[model samples]
Target: MRAHHRSRLLAATAAVCALSVALAGCSGTTKKDSKDDAKEKAQNAKADPDAPLKKGLKIAFLPKQINNPYFTVVDKAGIKGIKEFGGKGKEVGPSDPKASSQVSYINTLTQQRQNAILLAANDPNAVCGPLKQAMKQDVKVVSFDSDAGKDCRHVFVNQAGSDRLARQMVQDLSRQIDDKGEIAILSATQNATNQNTWIKIMKDELKKPRYKDVKLVKTAYGDDDDQKSFQETQGLLKAYPKLKGIISPTTVGGAAAARYVSGSKYKGKVVLGGLGTPNQMRKFVKDGTVKEFLLWDAQHLGYLAAYAGAALASGQITGKQGETFKAGKLGKYKVGKDGEVVLGPPTVFTKKNIDKYDF
Candidate 1:
């Protein structure tokens, strides 16, 4: 990553961390929950080397938000993985995606004594203090999709690098518009770490001489809400009528953007692409409103996150780079330097290949 890009990533991470710290400061309470867990875990660790086996455990897959199609897919996959492994796991998140909301959930989960927490932090480090407390209490902390504090989470399950996802979007959108004309990005929250990272990458990629003809008019935030995304799409069209393309890296934002276009005369005039569910993007594909889009198998992202969490919980593998573990049907995987398990490359969605995928 370039210095500017790296700075943005760190800034996003710091913003989240600052939120967590502020919340902690306001509460003025020590991590009593984590402490209790630590005492119990320590006793169990000494009593039985295979201590986790002696207890019924609850593992949480905490995404940035719940009910969104993207995280829903992940939740479904986590359910399957946990059931297969004979452990309890479920998806839990705030109704809306907010750093403060996530802090509340983390505190509640810690109070409930969840054995492990796999989070896709809404803000880069907003939930870090609570997560750190969980770790202190011997509650395993792992991150997926987006990361929290590095020292707080034992492992981070990454779908891919921000640059990789951004590059793919740029290539897809640029190709649709013949690499010329104005393009606008429909982003999620301005503070969303993953989206901002990808956006930075997209901006950097656009700066290359090969894309000199392509002008990025502006970027707008939808906050990952469907209605907001739809409105944002309209705003983009009004703000840049000559806009040749719109790229929304959020699942909801992309789908909503497509729907808005589907109802307008600009349907074919403006190309649309980004991260959207196959089911949601089907109509746009059929109507030729969207030429192409891309996303990973979200369920698999969740399944892999769970497997990684279980490995860390049982001490089967530490989140060290180059260390590999068997993930049943998903096969063996290695952790990267940042403790993330890359699910695989993003799968491009077009009419021809779209039918082959269910999630």
Candidate 2:
């Protein structure tokens, strides 16, 4: 029965226009319709950077998966930031990170008249229909971590520059394998925007003259599940005994891969690394299963997302390039092209510095 429900859900997500979502069915709301409505709504009131933030604004964060430790730190930090601005916020999400699992929550939040919905979209387009209806009702949409597509959201809070972070991870991994070996990527969900963006950039980067001998053996998805990632790591090594490294950019995937390699016969033979929180990767680093890894502070990422959402809901900004808003303690940040706000550079964690930080 659970499998049947999931199958139907997947079918609906694949054809969101043919089925009803949070605001009902999507019969006439095509991609062109959403874009057209956005253009029609473009005559928005001017943003006021100095406007005082309003009190008691209703905002909620929906991460890809609530069970993931990375998002736990992120969403809790978001709640902390919202309170600082006199707004009320909470974190809510599905235990499973399916593409369509977040749709029901989006509908419920819109019905509750939430002032804003801060989302880490599972799939860029899967959540667009409900998000558009939410916007039509005056609810602001701010995407963080992953995106809800440009037309569907008012702003995207990026942890770091996408291309820069992806390229940096590739370089970080390449050095560990001596820049020439069979390597595979164990990533999050296949449709995840952030993961896809990083994977594409990494693939493009590997084509350069600098990494000609580094053959990418395969790209596998663990769906951000710990056990699945562990198994995927095991499979990669077994399938390619000559594999020298595995790059997992998702926190869960990276940590799971490390755990797998640490206990298996592949320990020192196969290097495991990628975007990992300092605390989670510390043991792996100390045990010599991982040499180094990269990550931005998840707390800072969530904290910034909350302030950005509040700023939009308060009329302080309209997700336009060049507009700036003040994030409490973190200070001012300017929106870049397509409403992208980058947190900052990611830190590379090694055995020497992994113990110095937590979360």
Candidate 3:
């Protein structure tokens, strides 16, 4: 609710509106594909408004991986939301962050007859079959953070607009490096949907004339493990000695990169920026190892996902464009094309404002 947060949200909305217009004018197979997608959505839009959940609805959350701090925080917030709505909530997932690791859990939740399954998919396509089966069983599915395929979920709670977040990353890094230097990206898994999308948009942003002197030297995947991420940061420094900045869009990768840079020889020489929580990046910001980083409220992201799942299960709104629902505390949200719901814009964290936020 800060002024910075409001500006980011406005920027994100403007970016999404611009993208919608651009896509509308495209011709050829892209247009045909859009039409086909719309037809499919129309066919799947029917939901029984009379069939609300009975008492004590059971909801299960399956994050990409368990034991990761970021997912832990977000999942706890989801659980809180579910309980607030008088539903039972549970968290389940794999220890490792792999695309196929969540299949068994999805099957189990489906068999258990959960009212809804809130997921953060590791890969876009790997879990679609199991999720589709869950759908067949009348279990509503909503994805958050990282989404599965569109057909596999009822809704996706996007943390921020893809183009806006990507542009913010580039802008922050460029400011730190004086708009001219070699930079590298430390991403999560190679197949992560959100990470790949942001990376692609970042590549596009770098093509602008203002960034002509900026060179993307390399992109390395850390697999979302703290140790692996730390090692990857080390490898990037060694591989690109002239690297002036690093952008890591995963919380685990961002924190790991900050830790590595804060302790290593590149402490004050190389700048680090990306998506990280206030708790994880506070020390680095205070120490001057990381001057700026960005993240939305993960708690609110989870809370919104839970409410979206509840709305889908209760048939309050079908996953159609312009369908609106009220999420507790956050007010109303409208579903856009592809059943995507933007949580809000990201917040820029710095030493001056970092202490005001807890999550």
lDDT of each: 0.81, 0.89, 0.89
lDDT of 1 by residue, 171-276 (tens): 8889878899999999988777688788889999999887999999999999989999999999999989899999999999999999999999897899998898
- Who wins the TM-score comparison? 2
lDDT score for candidate 3 against the true structure: 0.89
Superior candidate under lDDT, 1 versus 2: 2
Stretch of 10 with least lDDT, candidate 1: 46-55
Candidate numbers, best TM-score first, in rank order: 2, 3, 1
| Cα distance off (Å), candidate 2, residue 259 | 0.4
- For every candidate structure, what is the RMSD over all alpha carbons to the true structure, in angstroms? 11.6, 9.8, 15.3
TM-score of each: 0.84, 0.90, 0.87
Clashing residue pairs in candidate 1 are 16-125, 16-126, 17-125, 34-137
| Candidate that would win on lDDT | 2
Provide the lDDT at 288 for model 1.
94
lDDT of 3 by residue, 1-359 (tens): 69999999989987876777666642232444432343255346776544554448899999989898888889999899989889999999999989899999999999999999999999877888888878877788899998887888888999999889999999999999999999999999998999999999999999999999999999999999999999999999999999999999999999999999988899999999989999999999999999999999999998999888888878776788778888878998999989899998999999999999987
Backbone clashes under 3 angstroms, per model: 4, 1, 0
Hey, what RMSD does candidate 3 come out at? Answer: 15.3
